[model samples]
Target: MKNKQLTFFLMAALFLIPMQVKAEQVNLYAAGSLRAALGDVAKAFEAEIGNQVATEFGPSGLLRQRIEQGEAAHVFASANMEHPQNLVGQGQKGPVALFTRNNLCALAQPGQTVTTATLLDVMLDPAVRVGTSTPKADPSGDYAFELFGKADQLKSGSTAILTAKALLLTGGPDSPKAPEGRNLYAWVMDEQKADVFLTYCTNAVLAKKELSGLQIISIAPELSVGADYGLLVLDGASQEAWRLALFILSPEGQKILGDYGFVVGGLPAKP
Candidate 1:
């Protein structure tokens, strides 16, 4: 009887030990723009590895500030290279990978017909409103500013006109939220706050998918700008964090980003 009882206890311990081990969770911080694609990737990774991924999504700069303030996060996925390189500069030794690229686009409000040729003109109309994310806090806004600068080159003083008329609506602490909807941009448009917004093509796609009657006006190549996304694992991160970072850098991960409308190829070589 004593031998049988000892064996039973040993068997129970084996079951409990692995369960406890699998309870470990990986914390990941990603740019708001990556939410849809990364969320799916995280789900797959968790199922395959038997671990949980807790994600925090926000503007790249805001997320960077959180990490710099010592907020508990293992991986940082940024909308641009600057924030991650800043982390590496501060002593986090990790290979910075350029994982994806996104281009600027104009998301027009419902029934607002516009083409690439007429994009700047439509936005410039005194009657039409324009929305943009906050500069410095969100790379999307910075990209918009660059496009505006290009417009200035096309027509002298156009940049100042656009800047003066533009509304800084997204990316900061006062960023707008979707009305219990899947697409955040749709809600902003529904509010009639702006007739159009300058953001990434990927984000515009997301908005179109979630809302009907939205038109995406491509930016002409001559005046177009693209954003490069960066990913890195901070020093002192858990083994799980490192694993996730590697998984995201893997080819399989690149496919996920591509499916979400990121330009998968033609990026700088991965580190």
Candidate 2:
């Protein structure tokens, strides 16, 4: 009789386990630059749970606007902390968790002579056609603008000159097209539109993979800028949302992000 009772309890425990597993489908909004990295990470999450993680990707600010407009999303993964922190401040979300960091680089074709020790000197060059994303719409662009602001402090009037000369060429759908894993700046270079593109290091890495001879130039250390990618599970979201957030901060997720060229926990202070 005791043996029979043990078997029955074992069966009940097995049945109860599935009930604890979150089975609700989840919606995920993310920054476009995360495409290669997060795609695999989301698949890993899906493999662990039968629930689906439907994702939408775009410029981080635009994604933030969508979330603010009452768009239904269980979680948001952004290119920077400001958007996630904004939601947290509004009580629309929980505490922001930073997962990774990315630094800016200039993409140029081989022999383009694009690497200047200082980004200010590069942008300050009247002859160098520089390209940047639209500020306030993309975190990458915001980083670029921050660097420009720094340039202003360093040289008094450098910011105005850089901003005026920059070709605001990519980031959103409305921006001119290059290839999708695109360095529109490079595309412009290919077409002679611009000399160099200011973009995430990872994007420049991907661009180099597609087209050989694409050179990545470092942003001068003095004016270096970094992007902090943040994650948040919206308040009252399904349990799966938090699960995905935790999974992204897990070692496996960090590895995936590292593989894609992001600094796992932010870059070493620009030495």
Q: Tell me the tens digit of each residue's lDDT in model 2 across 42-121.
A: 99889986778898878888889888899998889999999989988887747888899999988875767655565567
Score each candidate by Cα lDDT: 0.87, 0.82
Most accurate candidate by lDDT: 1
Clashing pairs in 2: none
For candidate 2, the lDDT comes to: 0.82
lDDT of 2 at 75: 88
Candidate that scores best on TM-score? 1
For candidate 2, give the lDDT of residue 146. 83
**Could you tell me which 10 consecutive residues in candidate 1 have the lowest summed lDDT?**
15-24
Model 1 over residues 27-124: C-alpha lDDT tens digits?
Answer: 99999999999998898789878779999998999999999999988899999999999989988897888888889999998778688999988888
